[model samples]
Target: MAVVGSGVAGLVTALDLLDRRPELTVALIDKGVSGESGSTPLAQGGLAAAVGPDDSPAMHAADTARAGDGHTDPRAVAVMAAETPARVADLRRRGAVFDTQDDGSLALAREGGQQVGRSVRAADATGAEMFRALRDAAIEKARNGSLVRLQGMVVDLPLATTPEQPVIGAWLLCDEIAGGMATPSQDAGLVLLRAQAVMLATGGCGGLYAGTTNRDEATGDALALAGRAGAALQDLEFVQFHPTGLKSADGRFQRFLLTEALRGAGAHLLDADGNRFMLDRHPDAELAPRHVVAKAILDQPGGAWLDARMIPDHQLAEEFPTVLTGARTFGFDLATEPVPVEPCEHYMIGGVATDLHGRTSVPGLYAAGEAASSGVHGANRMAGNSLAQSCVFAHRAALDMAARLDGAHADTDPEPPTFGRDTPVTADGSERTDLRTAMSAGGGAIRDADGLQKLGQVIDDLRAAAYRAWGGPKPPMVRDALEVDSMLVSARAIVDSALHRTESRGAHFRTDYPDHDPVWAGRRQRVQLTG
Candidate 1:
């Protein structure tokens, strides 16, 4: 009855639930406007689907598993790959117009870790186009009164009054930030929204890092909320870094991502001396898996850059207009100049543990998108798979939730919700900054035992300080306060999982144990926080 966040998963889940059971009361809750928020709009790499004549779901699955490093879930990968084409078609039906070839076929582009071109794109603004269609559809559904939109966040999962269910609703914290009115008191923003079920489509935690491509809103609230509610968070160590983030000289512009499709369009990776170097690192070179290419760039002594000047100006204007305009804003021209590039935190592969259908360990609880660790991408995610994974799993979760409610006494008109009171822990700004710095230095693209140990200690100290502030009279629960809490808990879980996994595998690499261990294959580290 309640879905959190408003990305592809959140929107589609709400839509599909209405499709299956027309009588259900669905509340689509989000911290921003239902359609314009979350990381889905930031997805520029496009969605991976088997649309090429030579491409197939089997090949897509193979590439997904290979990018996953060593421990991706086989069943989840198969489901995502098989269902992706249908999801793409659904997007098209919803009004997404992708670029097409001369024969009017979908324009499939190749990215890293792919054997062939299979990712369908809309120039370089694929995510924007997808979000536009999804947003319009969601808004139309809202107009028809199929679902009501709540501009707020769910702080905790509360239990039902009945003994039969463990968690039957959510605790919301609304504020003026989303144009919602909170209580007169600063520390009084809790409202109990009891429902038939609760879904978390809140996206990943990339905003926790100092150098990340995620928006400021992406603070891993789902991971923090789930861990506190006794749900297991799995594979917390495998955070993926994108290989090409714009880093211009003189620091004039802030960092932004250069989509993998740019490289697929015949761009080159150049060393400091303007010589191609990716070929020496891997057979696929610029098209190699993200982890290999990211690591190679970090290993460069002077630094690396992306040379897109070789790409035709007309093609660049048509296919990479967004990228070109963005680059020009930072004093670089993609069609005529080379731009400095480096790896930055792009995606989080680990998240709240969930089954293939988005059901978490807790009953009546589910998750999708980057928030759910479905194990489809074991160690790392290939470019564009996040969009496909989100769409596929959200549809499945919606179908399952609808089946559970069909003639099964689901509360269509739940009792009017009430308010609850509590002292929210104050966020320590200085400690928050230290946490990000420590995470970036110790648990970032490369890791070692010493660094992870230090990072763990930093998290422990910050967490203790954060809780100590909750003992006295409570202050207002500001946005930064919520984000800092999320950052601390998430940072602790990630570092703890990274420390537990000794061997280097996938996106998680340890300098101490640089080789893959046969004993660790098909294995993963899961964390369930008690505090």
Candidate 2:
């Protein structure tokens, strides 16, 4: 089996497959180095699970449903919440250590939308700890010949013998940095490997927006690849914007994020005059659902700030070393200053649609992590729920893939297609920066119909220019094809979905339609490419 992406979801999926079916050969592919593409490594908040004695799966499920604004599938939410405890236990068995209280109970912190303190963390760097453990486990297994780590970018899913047949494998482009140089020799060109099943855990589409807490590789590659292969997609418009990204001096840009965990730990959101703002906006104040808080911040005049001064310095240093260090590096003291903040693209609430078992519409294909819309985070996502969702669904996908392999089936792998010999080279350093700038400015937190329409046109023009520059009639090499195809497809999807959803709901707010409509409630709009 083949798994794309090296995040927590991909690594766990691979490990689960190895444990479940030791005989199956698995290949794991990633665009960057292993453990780089996923937001898992950058996550500050911990996994949201009912690990406390006072917590229950039902309570977790209810919080999830309520946060999603009634669009969440009850079955999916229940499945995730019910399986969360076991998943946490599995992580512990694999050497993941969650922070514990003085009384010997698991330390649970709260985030937006939770009734009880249930977020399990590790020194405020929860993602780093999870990534390290998962990566070490996967690497050990890979070294022992249980799995293969393909360091390359996946271009497309190669078709099987028939259109209705299961997917056999993917076409890959091998590109890795060696000796501080990016070598693009033909020896590192296209490669094809047959697999029993394919799982896409390729993170999220956060990079499609201007400002995001996601890493550079979160470019919607999985969604675009699946869409090109005709997979079903849903809720493309529901992109969650976190309200606390550090703002730049210009007031038009944002830097890295200050996690929602700070608020859960007693920090407050204040206005420029040092007045607490959330209390006036919502009864729950800082503990309100993510979408509500984000919208409130956006609506508030002169923006907002996060007051972290209330926490003791020694305790802050102990619990949030990452944030504290980052603040120091930027020449600021978190204890004295109210951090300037604004909403930024924080999460994708929708992606390639999948079932409870991680089965997509396409045969022999499954997905997990932020790339798959399993209906867990419907219209809005709750803080810390993403990590739990990834872990639970990764195991589910692995089990389903193992089931398919155990059943009697004929070999369906087909000869892979070849790209043109004279494909255009991918962007150099300067060109890549330009592309990012264009995407960010044209598509950001605030959007108008005109800007979105113009952005769509710009993407189309860019694609045409890229095709013309390539000089050959056939598609370019896997790397170039993947980059161009992903950008074009993602841009089109976001623009089309934003245009279709005429009401302000969740993360998708239209200034043209400033008020939410009852008719638009509880409904998710699907997007597909049409002639």
Candidate 3:
């Protein structure tokens, strides 16, 4: 079995699968060191579970559906909400440590779009703590030879010629990226390997936007790879712009996240005039759903501010030490004044379509985490569900895949055709910046037919440039070029999906049609590549 990513989703899937069937062999592939890749380690918000005394899975499901603005799939949301507690407990048993109350009860925090304080935390760096636990377990497995960790970037998945388009394995490029530059060493080349099952747990496409809160590695590689392999994608347009991203001077095009737990702790969102603007925008004020708060922030004339000075100094230091450090890094003191913040692309709500068991349309090509859309978060995601969804769905996917692989299916599956690394492209590499700039300008925060159409034109132009570059010669398989190629596919899909739906819903807001349409309430848009 091959797990092509090492984030929380991939980690949980690999570990859980290994535990379920200890005789099975697994290979974990990633360009970054295991456990540190993707958005998981960078996540600050805690996981949401129904473990609180008064909370239950039914209540969690209701909140999840409400936050999605009536677009979430009931079955999928129920599964996620129900399984979250078990996953959190599993993490804790595996060594994850969370903050506890004075009596040693689990300390829970309230976040946006929740009726109760059900979010579990590790001092606002929850994901890091979870990853630390999982990472340590994974290292032990590797040392004991139960798992193989391969350092390589997966560039493509080998798909069969049949109409069903089953994937056999993955194609990897041995490359390196450092300080915004990609260079090939002597060993840098391509390799094709077969696997019983291929899991795409790669994170979201936030890197497609210019001013995103995601790191540079989130280039939508897995999303594009799955599509080209004939897997269907859903809801690519519903990119969640987090309501509060710390303003940065680093200018790396990536913004650090200011955890929503701040607002949950009574922080305020003030406009440039030093007025609490969110009160007029949503009934919940600063605690409104992410899309609501984000849209309201964009409406501010001079921009938005996160006023956390009202939070006690001790609380700021103890409960949100990450935010405290982030604020000071940008020369702002959360205990003294309001800090500048903006809405930036945070999460990809939709991804490669998956069933409740995490199977994509293409057989043997399963997906989970930010890379897969299990329909749990239909149009919008609830706060704190990202990590929960990742852990829950990945576990389900691994269990199902493990059972199938244990049967004769792994050997009886039709073989895919011989494949190689995708033909590379050559250019000065301005296409990447151009694509992100256009995506952020036309696809960020707000949308309409006109802006989406213009963005489509830009994607088309870049596609032409890449096609022309591919025709001329086989260029080096540089990481930047590969990422840009993937970005083009994901960006075009986003524009197409954004244009297909005419009405506003959750994170996808159209200026021309500012209200939700009853007709398209649960109608999910899907796309796949065809020859």
Q: Largest TM-score belongs to which candidate?
A: 3
- Tens digits of lDDT, candidate 2, 335-454: 888887888888888898999999888898888999999889978888779999999999998888777786344366556655554646545433334555666665555566777788
Lowest lDDT block of 10, candidate 2? 177-186
Candidate 3 at residue 510, lDDT?
A: 96
Q: What is the C-alpha lDDT profile of model 3 across 1-531, one tens digit per residue?
A: 889888899989999999998877777777675555688888887888999999999999999998999899999999999999999989988999999999998999999988889899999889889888987888877776677776677877876666666677787876543321111232566776667789999899987988887877798987788998888999888999998987765545437788998999899998888999988887888888999998898888887889988888888889999889877887888889888888889999999999988899889888999999988987888888999999999999989987888523233333432332355545576888889899999988899899999999999998787767766322236677677778888898889999999999999999999999999989999988652
The residue-level lDDT of candidate 3 at 402 comes to 73
Question: For each candidate, C-alpha RMSD in Å?
Answer: 3.6, 3.2, 3.7
Off by over 4 Å in 3: 160-165, 176-187, 248-254, 407-427, 472-476
What are the Cα lDDT values of the candidates? 0.82, 0.79, 0.84
Estimate candidate 3's alpha-carbon lDDT, on a 0 to 1 scale: 0.84
Q: Please provide, for model 1 over 1-531, each residue's C-alpha lDDT reduced to its tens digit, 9 standing for 90 to 100.
A: 888888888988988888888777777787765445688887887899987899899999999999888788999999999999999999999899999989899988899999999888999888888888887877777766677677666766765555444466787776544232211222336666767778898898877777788876788899988887778899999999999999868643255888899889899999988899998989988999999999999999999999998888898999888889998998888877788998888888999999988998888888999999999999989888989999999999999999886433344333433321245544447766787678888999999999999889888887777666644222235556667777887888898889888898989989999989998899878888885
Worst 10 residues of 3 by lDDT: 177-186
